[model samples]
Target: MQDLKGKVILISGASSGIGRATAELLASKGAKIIVNFRSNEESATEVVYHIKEMGGEAIAIKADVTIKEEVNAMVEHAINSLGKIDVLVNNAAGGIRQSTFIDASEDLWEETYKLNITSVLLCSQAVLKHMIPKGKGKIINISSTAARIGGAGESIHYAATKGALNTMTIGMSRELIEHGIIVNGVAPGVVETPFHEKFAPNDDRLTRMSASIPIKRIAKPIEIAECIAFLASESSNYILGEIINVSGGR
Candidate 1:
């Protein structure tokens, strides 16, 4: 049988980039999927259509994970439609603005934390009840390389939020392991996603960053998706509280 044939997975930020790619890949493997998006309804619907076209089961759910009520509603909707969620991929994140900590506004910092760290906390909490009852679950947080290698002239706020996520993953894993739930993370490096365009927007900076990678190339969303798939699958049963880097050896 396929590793995830009978599993139900919930993925946040499913409108684009790594989240969208992971949703597609997991759906192809026979997992019933709940594709959650804060905005970009069209893109989320397109993802669902693609999954359905491939003969995969999936549904697009609207939710802003940063909000507790919305996060709860999202999990409720998924459980109502798919029965129960066996996996939760906390992939929703904000883009980084090119500003140093001293120059950054307090609002930007707050927004970054809300989207990055708060969302993970809210979604994870919402899903815990369902997962604990079943006695097994997987939670994968899509973190970033910036959390390890801080960016210059960029949002220290965004990087800090990611670092908080890493800490949260570790702490949550320890707390949840006794319940038979596995918590892990994937910290991706420079990927060719809309995120960079929204932040850096400098073609030259993009080229330089790509060239700096050990592999001399940026990551594709699918490449990160594959790593997330492994963590979410039984193949990584023994690997808990680990953050797998998919940053092309950067």
Candidate 2:
């Protein structure tokens, strides 16, 4: 466990899935959490309630990370409420539907980039103002295996955006490391989350996807959260601009 007592961490899209798990885990390690949810207020509240029930501190804030104004307000609110933000988890992202690259519409491409790529950029920029001043911070982005393999027949746009994030992670780390801010990413494969329920839909599809992995099963949300927790901690201080693949060796 990292000594995160008094540390303030902000997690976007923290209503459920990997974001929620990361928030809870960090809270358990003594970090104060600012849970940012776009629409799922009830779920976000549950996350905060559970954290407090476990004697941890957490607060949920609503914000559409894709919008610059909203992103700015979210960061300001977190700083005002928690005094400072020591870590940022850019975990808010989604795919509309799996489609072939050529068959993908312009709207789908735009929306995918807005939520997955632009949101990360907006959130990182907003938090960098405060982190740079402190001379120490962590920015952990949630990427995907799709980025490397290319989701050609399945969510190619989504995969492209994650690839953009991967590049940004490397670029930002080099730009900010001199200021003591470490930027890294986590690429998860076939995780059991709401994302799969919405995107995959069919149980048989998920089973087949899991069977393809070397581990022969999908990952639990907590598994990915553990990796994010490590990146957010001081233990990863020497690790910068790297994306750790938690892909079950896929």
- List CA RMSD, all candidates: 1.2, 1.0
Full-model lDDT, candidate 2: 0.92
Give residue 32's lDDT in candidate 2 (0 to 100).
98
In candidate 2, what are the lDDT values of residues 36-56, reduced to their tens digit? 999999999999999999999
Candidate 1 achieves a global lDDT of 0.89
Residues 89-112, model 1: lDDT tens digits: 999998535667778888888888
lDDT of each: 0.89, 0.92
List candidate 2 segments past 4 Å from native: none
Every model's TM-score: 0.97, 0.97
Error of 2 at 212 (Å): 1.0
lDDT of 2 at 182: 92
